[model samples]
Target: MIPIRDTAPCHSRPVVTWSLIVVCTVIFIVMQWLPYEVSYRLIHLYGMVPLRYSNPDWALAQGLPFDGYLSFLTNLFLHGNWLHLITNMWFLWIFADNVEDRMGRVRFLIFYILCGLFATYLQWYFDRTLEIPVVGASGALAGVLGAYFFLYPMARVILLPIPFIPFIFNVPAIAFLGIWVIIQLHNATTSVVFKGVSVDVAWWAHLGGFIAGILLYRYFIKPQAEE
Candidate 1:
């Protein structure tokens, strides 16, 4: 389901959200202009590779530079392709503004980074032996969606379900995010059983970020003014 927009309104401009989008877009453009080999090397150097942490000796033996765990944050800004970047930024555009509005800029930024870090580590925990470098903002964006799931549960979301005749329908935020979480769990389970952590999609990262957002948002949420 593609989320077009939501009925929830924001009280202030989402500066942090816009800044994140612009930064990701510019980095992706630079990545596209780079040579294929350079781009590949860049992703490996910055993207989160579980084996880098799980087996430092192996990573060093393979000539992978020690990034000193910074990849946990850097990986959130890297994208594998245009589609991957666009889809993640689009979700952030739709949902992150409201989250930022509720939490304020500083707290929202901290929450986002923490969720992304949690997501990366959780993926590493299960796929420590895998050599693939995970890149993209989906896990962090999933955190935004999870925050929306709690902060605006009753807000109506417009979803376009394709494959069948294209049509739009409004559903509660809780239901939409609930379905998203279920799909992630199913895919994560399938990846573990069949692909054994060698899959392209970081389903566990998404699940971890979503769970982190749900669990941590309350602490970061701003207190409401007394009526």
Candidate 2:
């Protein structure tokens, strides 16, 4: 289901959330104008490639900086295409505000980066030999979705379950996020079954990020903080 928005309200401005959307958007626009070769190089250099880090000698042979660990954070700002960028930013727009409000801007930003890092590393563990570059904010955004599932379980979400039908369905946040988890789990298990096949999406990253968020959010959230 395509989540349009959530009924939960943010008591404070979601500065970190908005900043993330804008930065990712600007980076994506700049990437679109680069030459194909340059763009491919940038995607590989900046995106988290499991094989690149797993085998330092191979990475050096490929002219990649073997010691560079910055891709763990950089990959969150890079996306493959318009759909990828749009879907991730849209999910952030819908759900991140309340999370930011709960955790505060600085904490929210830290939480996001940590989740993304954790996710990338987890993906690396499962596909250490795969040469594909894993890019996009989906993993980090999955973290936010997981936090939202815990933070606002009863909150109402407006969804477009069927786009062409123009139907709007309102459901509990838990239900929507639960469906998301199921989808990720199913895809991750399927990916495990076909181990040799290279897949475009990082299903394991999604599951890892979601699990990390659920487990780590409480530590970030400050219940007694001022509004």
Candidate 3:
């Protein structure tokens, strides 16, 4: 199920969220226009590789403070392809605004980065031996989805059944986000059994972000008085 939008009322404009989306899109567009070698180099330089980060020798040679320590932050902005970039950014657009409205600009930025950092570490911990580089903002976006689930559980979200199917169904935020989390859980579990080798994508990062988001929401957002 794909989320089109939510029913929660957004207060002030989500400057930080929109700006981040614009920045990511611009970076992706520039990379797309560049030659394959340049684009590939850019992703490698910015993306997070668990093995590269876990090795102190390589980190010393590359002048990095430590190996995987820094990749957690850099990896959030990296994407493998146009499709990856677009989908991640699209989700960011759909869900981030309301989250930012709830958290405010500065706090929201911190929340996003912190979630991304924690999520990346979780992914790395699951498979530190893998050399494949993990990239994309899905982990952070997953955090946004998690927050929305709690911040506005009663909000209506428009979901698309398929690419062409125009089924405009409104579901409660809890159910919507719950289904998303379940889907990710299903895929992550099945991947372990079906694929002998781990996939490059960081499914655990998505899970970690979700848990972090849920916890953060409970801590930061106070309960409103019932009408």
Clashes of each: 0, 0, 2
Top candidate on TM-score is: 2
lDDT tens string, model 3, 1-227? Answer: 77787778887898999888888888878988999988876676677777776785774665444533666788888788888888898888878889888777877888888889878888888767666678889888888888988878888888886778877788888887888899888777776678685565678889889888887765544235410
lDDT per residue as tens, model 1, 68-155: 7999999999998888999999999999999999999999999999999999888888788879799898888888888899899999
Q: Model 3 lDDT vs. the true structure?
A: 0.79
**TM-score list, all predictions:** 0.94, 0.96, 0.87
Model 2, span 1-227: residue lDDT tens: 78888999889989999999999999999999989999999999999989898898988888788646899889989998999999999999999999999999889999998899888888888888878789989888989998999999999999898878898989999998998899999988888897766577999899989998998999999769455
Candidate 3: segments with Cα more than 4 A from true spot? 57-68, 192-200, 219-227
Total clashes, candidate 1? 0
What is the C-alpha local distance difference test score of each model? 0.90, 0.90, 0.79
Worst 10 residues of 1 by lDDT: 191-200
Model 2, position 139, has a per-residue lDDT of 84
lDDT of 1: 0.90
